[model samples]
Target: MSDWKLFTDAACTEEFGGTLTTVHKTNFSDNPQDFVLYFANVAGDPGDNQVLELVEATQPGTNYLTMSIVDANVGSGHEADEITLATTAAGLDTAIAGASLDLGQDDDSIGVIRLLSGVSAAQEIHVRVENAVPNEGTSTELSSAMVEAISRTKSTA
Candidate 1:
């Protein structure tokens, strides 16, 4: 099995909490691969709460990627979060395993590592962050560890 690693890490600013936006993209070779979504950072109003969503790019007229948290079953309405592993064929919404991320006084940031199944030198990957709930949220760019780790694994394989 190809082992995936961390390539990038990102932290969203206060300005990003307003709308959904693309944080960063990893330029990979044109190859089919699987991706694991990791929670790098998280922060919100402790009292009110919020949820963050990670989704895959949709391909018009296709049912893919489900909008659901992995660890926390709470809808995008409270202070909870989740993670999942996704693939180009499957998508982000559909994940195998994930977990909820809670923000503490100092635990305002989370980092996730994705493992690529089969990536070539032509295909690329990107991550999108959406403030599902309303409170306050931010994330760092995909960590270098996360990005480099993935490619390195491919080389060894």
Candidate 2:
């Protein structure tokens, strides 16, 4: 699969329940060239009010990266949810300048983004749940599991 794997954060508190996970190559192999980041809601009780964040370990200047997420779930709750991986509002807007993203629908959804070369290979990439209001438990588990699975796939591939 892929060399990347999930490394759980032990510093997360109840305010940030569950672990914030990062996916990276096992050995941080020769500057990851081409790869598409994918995330899906695999197993969890469906609900609304769920949000996920994609974060990258970054330095002041050297590295920059941008990507957008598109939900792939089917049916009503499967409405396309797109989010750009940016730390600033301006950056996010720039990243999704021409993309059409819908935030409507229940919390049960999956999204994926294509990683570009601007992102630093030395940085760790991951997703963070912003508000786990309605489905905190299930969201935490499912999201973590989804990331874990994807990282495993990359590692094994």
TM-score versus the correct structure, for each prediction: 0.23, 0.24
Clashes of each: 46, 13
Question: In terms of TM-score, which candidate is strongest?
Answer: 2
Candidate 1, residue 149: CA error in Å? 4.8
Best by lDDT: 1
What is candidate 2's CA lDDT for residue 139?
19
Off by over 4 Å in 2: 6-70, 87-90, 97-121, 124-157
Writing each residue's lDDT as its tens digit, candidate 2 over 59-126 gives 21112223234443423221222123333333443444223322111212232321211112212323
Candidate 1 on 29-51: residue-level lDDT in tens? 32222332333223221221222
Error of 2 at 154 (Å): 17
